[model samples]
Target: MQLNIFELTSIYLYITLAACAFYLAIMFFQKINRTRGSGVDLGPIFGLGFFVLFFGIVYVCWGYMHYFGYEYDFHPLPLYKTGILMTYFALIGVVFFSEKIIGKTKFAFTFFSIGCCVYGIFFTFTEFDLRLFTYITNPITVAFILISFLYFLKVKTTGEIRKQMFSAFLCYIGFLIFFLLDIEGIKALLPFPMEISSIISSIGVIITLVYLGTIFLRFETFTEFGWKDKLRELYIIAPNGTTLFHYSFIRDERNQDLDLISSGLTGVEGILGELIQSKKKLKIVDHQDIKIIFEYGEYTTIALITYENLRIYLPKLTSLRVKFEKLFQDVLKDWSGRIEVFRPANHLVNEFFG
Candidate 1:
């Protein structure tokens, strides 16, 4: 059976969106399981993933409807899709913000929810005029996307993730403009078949999915370490419970007891592993309202004791672990546990992640 352009586009969208959803789920799972230093919660991303899947299904149904020349009006649909999408994105902002004042901002979520409700109700009672409704919702959709992109720009110090996200947002905005123009009956101005516009829109969505997948999956190399004053203490320990090196803001004897802290943390690690039945290397312990974070290296494990938010300090910790393991590979092999040999590590702490 020969498929029309719309059907083929829908099939491609289905495949693309399905892949996006699957990758997002996998990323979230891996993120939760990883023993990284930072405690960036990947839970909020699930909302974005589900949104992609829902939109995928909606596109499929919409294509079939067009293919069969079947026309039906679902007045709430426009509001629902856009509103819920903005809501999901707002939630994502919370995850990215994580413990920041903006992350604590419930206003965005509240505003989006109210907008969706009002838009849904307005569309339900009033006639669904694509032109008029597009006029109302399209700007809001574009503004939300632009604002999200701008926020990402402002907060992102590492150009890698920022660049990827910025590219995705650009594509999404292009697709949005095309979609609105098509709805406004301006597709004829394109001087090309409408099918070409559809193809371009699909391409935009696909590119957006690719970038989002890459950024959220932690596949990018982030050189910009933003943890300046957040990290309180860091320790590198051998597999045999020997403390290789440690740095702390606290100069007292109590904080200098790396051996005691390492042993205790090791024991806690075993108990937690057995309890959870998982081998994740990252561990966070709360004591006296302070966070104790652990990140494992090849022959050593790094522990960070900090009062700062885990989400903010984790990536820096991970960088410290990697740099230490690589720089001290030779020293780490011998039986000697001289803390003086790792003196250069202090410079590392002061330079890369300080």
Candidate 2:
């Protein structure tokens, strides 16, 4: 069947969108594997992957409807509803990432996300009413955008992070605006010649790709961690000076001698405690180019090696120790000398350090 000029342009744009969504989902899922132990949260990446997977399906169905359904008056209601439903999950992924990348987030943003989740579930079961659509979206979605944007704006951070944040903001804002205008009455109002809205919506796909690249780069270079400089390794050593676990920040290399050195340091800490030292365990000791900061727990000592003094990260270290002890409290009391028992602590390190 022959199509009009405007319909053809829209078909092309929506097809482009479908392709972008498919690739975007692949990118996020690839990043999920790529970013392991890199201290970037997987929750957001997982959420986005799910979002784009559904998004691609949504657009594919829409494209099919546009191309063939024009004559038949067809609407793929179930597919559309399912895709729209995933929008709530998309916000969940972005929100999880935002708190870490942006700053301490307001409670309202989370509340709005939960509210949208309810709306999404509700809409999926019931037939959509445009009268209800605008009313449901107007207050909540708009406020969610504003509240999230304003919170990020007020957060004080480095120039580099802020630039990336703006890129994220652009991608997010563009997607929401495009999503809002996607309904029948509003879509019909667009200029029939070029279907400018479709073209603009396609731009959001580009923005999303760029934003994802920036996030991947930031995690790779470890520059996103403004507070850390040359973080080398983390070791959790038992009180008996056996290395329970060792995690290296940089990939593809491990210092085998660190176990011996850490054992010796534990010895030194004990010796110094006895020789002209109070019972206080040595917290930090300086080497030529690296600083070792240790946090003592009832069952273990947590050692972090870095180029710069990380006394400032003591709170995180302390928190890790607390959580680890709680998580492994029973295991510690019965304390098998086996080091593998504490492998779960790696996740705690990612959470606190990331």
Candidate 3:
């Protein structure tokens, strides 16, 4: 079977629309489940879902128009423009409402949504005049992509959200690059046809959609870690002066050896978890002045205490005892309060006894 470029483009667009519809439906239901009992705002899910549905339908219509060669009015009147604006308003309402409801970053969502709204309005007016609209919307879209990319990059400091945000950032950059390359002026400079540019742009869009879908599906996983994890770690390591440990030592409580604290240090928690597990003894020197001491092998590492958690991993075992002490001292020197580190007076005896 032979297929023309137009047919292939339509097929791709249809597939994209179908995937988007399924994604929106799933997210809508998930949001509904959360807001079922309480008097929570359903605007975000409703708005987002509505926009997705509407956009999908519009694309389908466009596809049909292209396939059939229908002389459809691409441009709309002022009233129709108002209706398009309403769609954007719905999107904005949903983004803001959902951000508040879900306790996500508001600024990021607001900027991206508003950018989309502005672009939507631009497209609405320029439908009848592609040349004018192309000039305006292309630059505007590129600017939005850059802004969104930066925002995602900034919010990605936390390890949990970093991967998804990075993926999103790549998508935006990809789109921006494609648009820049596909412009008539740029195409003239390039040897290859513009079709290659479209393919690359489409791939970027696909990646962006996948990342967005992953984020929606794994909302809990991408969210920042609450204070509970820190509190729990602190509670467990209270007996030990060293509240923080290397990432290699922390183990889940289930696998922890009741008789040997070191056993708990070997399991899979981050650096902080391992430190709490590795320490032989823990004590609070003064309640008013929080301080922690850990006895590891033949050295005692002391630290002035703070709520901040610490996780470090020393990959090598040879001469680890000295390395651990030096690391602890380095940390102490950076802090404001006084901290001390001392080798055990009877090092040989301590080593022999242990």
Candidate 4:
């Protein structure tokens, strides 16, 4: 039997969502394995998988209904609006747990999400109307797009700001396509099937999933520690023995190695001071069951201490030191000594060596 456009589109969308969800689920599992002991929060990445999985289930249901020739208005399953609302909720979770936004901005996003959820629930109980659903969701989607764009514009962090913004934009445009398809007269403009809405929107979602996958691949928030010993502390010190930035992976206060490292470096600048005489780029000190690695730059010095014999990080330390000096050359020269000027160095350290 020849298939109608609606049936074809529904089948395509169902297959696409299901496939994308399956792929993401596998990636998420591997990501967890990859970051097992790195103390990295996997919530945001899990949310991404859940978001696609939730919508995939919804699309399969919708596809089954369409395949059986059950009209949405008459179908017993009132899943359409609820699915979209929950999808938005999932996206909100992604944004929240990603640690991309914090402070008052994160709070504002949370507040807006709650408002939308409450509003969507009210209408779902009362009318469950598609038009009302679209109207309510459109504003929320647009708000997400705008907020993401604003974040991308305002922030200078190393996180995937552009990818996040573009993903939100794709979602908004996908919803727009879905909305336009349901309009009274817009259907006449397209000679194709009304189900083109599903096709277009599914394409948008597929693109979004692809983008997210790329973000996942490029993600370096977590590092695999094959052994029990792990990197415990990292610090950048200025030429004047000033602490420019400090990061500690060891959470326990009892582990005073970080303090000792700082104090020892402050007094003599042992490895840092030796850089001029030895003319060496990297130095390694294995002292008292800890390995301290130093990478010297023209204006700044980088120090890393780890319990493990992780010799592979020496090159990374050198690269970080070089980038730090180059990126903060002007500030290093002026040296007002206010630590705030080097706040950005925190992000650099985390991104490059954390």
Candidate 5:
């Protein structure tokens, strides 16, 4: 039988949403499959990716069954119950990942798993409830969004990455809001039918996630390649060849001459500037297994020392340098001996390099 315009539109909408989700899912999985890296665990990303992938597949299935079964046979969709359950399973990866980044324990997602199993099995016997979908997805989506936003909020720096993160935040908030528009209070603002808004909500979720995935992929590529694990220390050097503050990534009690390292770096610009007599200056120093990356600021210099294979982290390193310089601009001018004032900078160190 021929379908009405509304049916055809929904079929197209779901297909489009599914395509976007699959593209994002493939992109993330391909990154993992291509190589193993030593950066922060990407297990959370795997979970979030699966969330998108499963939902994408679910949309396709929904489109098919909504056309065939619901539109004609008036039957329940039992397969979608499994799809929803699997999507919840993907969030477990996110909980562990979020904890590491936010450095906070959240037990809510733990409960979400229990709810997913119980509710999923219970609902397995019933028909797919479009009205209940918002009630189910909103809680977890809001939680993840809050966790990620908090992680970025704790950082005391700004630049291109921060701006991009803001965009991601807006997209996710839009995703949540689209789902919420079904409520009477919110429905007035958009005034679209619930059916169209639900499609919009799914699209919102997929598009926002893909946007975040792009940012994560670039940063995680180096991190996964050992940038995070290989990192050893960050040193904030005063203009007068003194160590203002230092942060060690790994717990190493071994005594080392950080002051000497600071003193040696004091002339790096002058020496390299004199030799080349050019605007370009040397930034990285490689000695055996250790590589030192430097970022210069008006008040002081930031030095990051790491083990081999960490080719990049300059954006974060630059962010650290910016925060430290701004935080200690006055102190650097007077040249005080007390390092206590710089102690607060440890938060900046951990935010970027922790």
Candidate 6:
């Protein structure tokens, strides 16, 4: 029993392709499940499906070359032609779909994708004409990578969307690095054989796919937080529930003036007030909507408020007088179960009035 280099390469290529295909399938199904009613345009999924298919074909060709001992160049014949065309088309689909689904960043990516396609076509015909396609794709890839990096940095304030964008930016960086290596013939400078170039490029491809998968899975996590921020801003004009107000005052009289109150504070107000007056120092053993985990002198409360409810509830508690009274009651209850009996001072009201 003996194993030749060709057989070994063929086995490795088959294993890699199988792994990639399995991973892509998992991603595809996950996207289908998550995006079913998300209102996102479906173009990216279609484009990615095609891209994956073409990539599979490339791997199949590589496996065949290894098995048959064919003297095939890296970018050979019909595979090269079809692969380049499909790659460009799929990339264009991704750009258009991303722009439509996510807000548009710049049209520069569109032009860059088109340029890559044109250069790729030239390379398919010219047979590893590195000077032509590499020159065009290298600069364009680098430029897009830089642009996306900056865009992500600017917008990645806080949230899942920021994380996805950052991941995509990292993928672009990997893409740029591998591409530059290819363009500068740095792989040739290495002592190992040129096949290592393919391995390096495969790493970039894998990273890009992983980033895309994360984006597809976590799109809601990214965009929903932005909506939450906007809702929070609008909540400033809203009224706090009675319960929320009482809690605020129980916490601190000053908190009433500051308008720091929860939206769902209505129901718990009476109960909290009783507890505060009694000086019971009660710990919430178990509760729903809001959980109070109290031990010793410290109290922790976790409230679950939906985005819709928060938006709807906040505006009703608009008057400064109402907010202040609620906050005072909440603060009083919070501070060692001691109730405070004091009205806002006349001059203080006029100067630092709500």
Shift in Å, residue 204, candidate 6:
6.8
Model 1: per-residue lDDT, tens digit, 196-315?
565665566666655655665553222222333345777788888878887876555363577887787777887888898896754788765477888877888887877645354677
- Tell me the tens digit of each residue's lDDT in model 6 across 59-175: 555455444433432344565455446545555645643443345655567677777777677644553563456455646544554664465456533333456567766766775
Candidate 3 per-residue lDDT, tens place, 1-354, comes to 444684566447545754775576567667768756544345545554564555445334433443343234333344344434544454454455345434546557657667766776665444444334445544543454455446545643344344655765675466347535534467577776544544454455455545554554454322222211222221112123332332211245354332244333322223555667855344222333232323334333322222222221111122344554455555444543322222221342223111
Cα lDDT computed for each candidate against the true fold? 0.57, 0.66, 0.43, 0.60, 0.65, 0.45
**Which candidate comes out best when scored by TM-score?**
5
* Per-residue accuracy of model 2 over 43-75 as CA lDDT, tens digit each: 556655766666666676667766665545565
- Candidate 3: regions farther than 4 A off: 1-12, 28-32, 35-55, 70-126, 129-145, 175-204, 221-354
Question: For every model shown, what is its TM-score relative to the native structure?
Answer: 0.55, 0.54, 0.44, 0.57, 0.63, 0.53
lDDT by residue (tens digit), candidate 4, 150-232: 55434523224445445655555564466355343565677786566556656666665656556554544322212213677
**lDDT head-to-head 1 vs 5, winner:** 5
Give the CA lDDT, 0 to 100, for residue 32 in model 3. Answer: 66
Better of 1 and 6 by TM-score: 1
Ten-residue stretch with the least lDDT total in model 3: 309-318
- In candidate 4, clashing pairs total 0
- Enumerate residue pairs that collide in model 2: none
| Residue 348 miss distance in model 4 (angstroms) | 13
Q: Could you arrange the candidates by TM-score from highest to lowest?
A: 5, 4, 1, 2, 6, 3
Error of 3 at 161 (Å): 2.3
Error of 3 at 158 (Å): 2.5
Clashing pairs in 4: none
What would the per-residue lDDT of candidate 5 be over residues 65-168, giving only the tens digit for each residue? 55674367553456556545555554544554454455445656556665665666665455445337535664765577576665664462244555655775
The 10-residue segment with the lowest total lDDT in model 1? 219-228
Candidate 5: residue 178 Cα off by (Å): 3.1
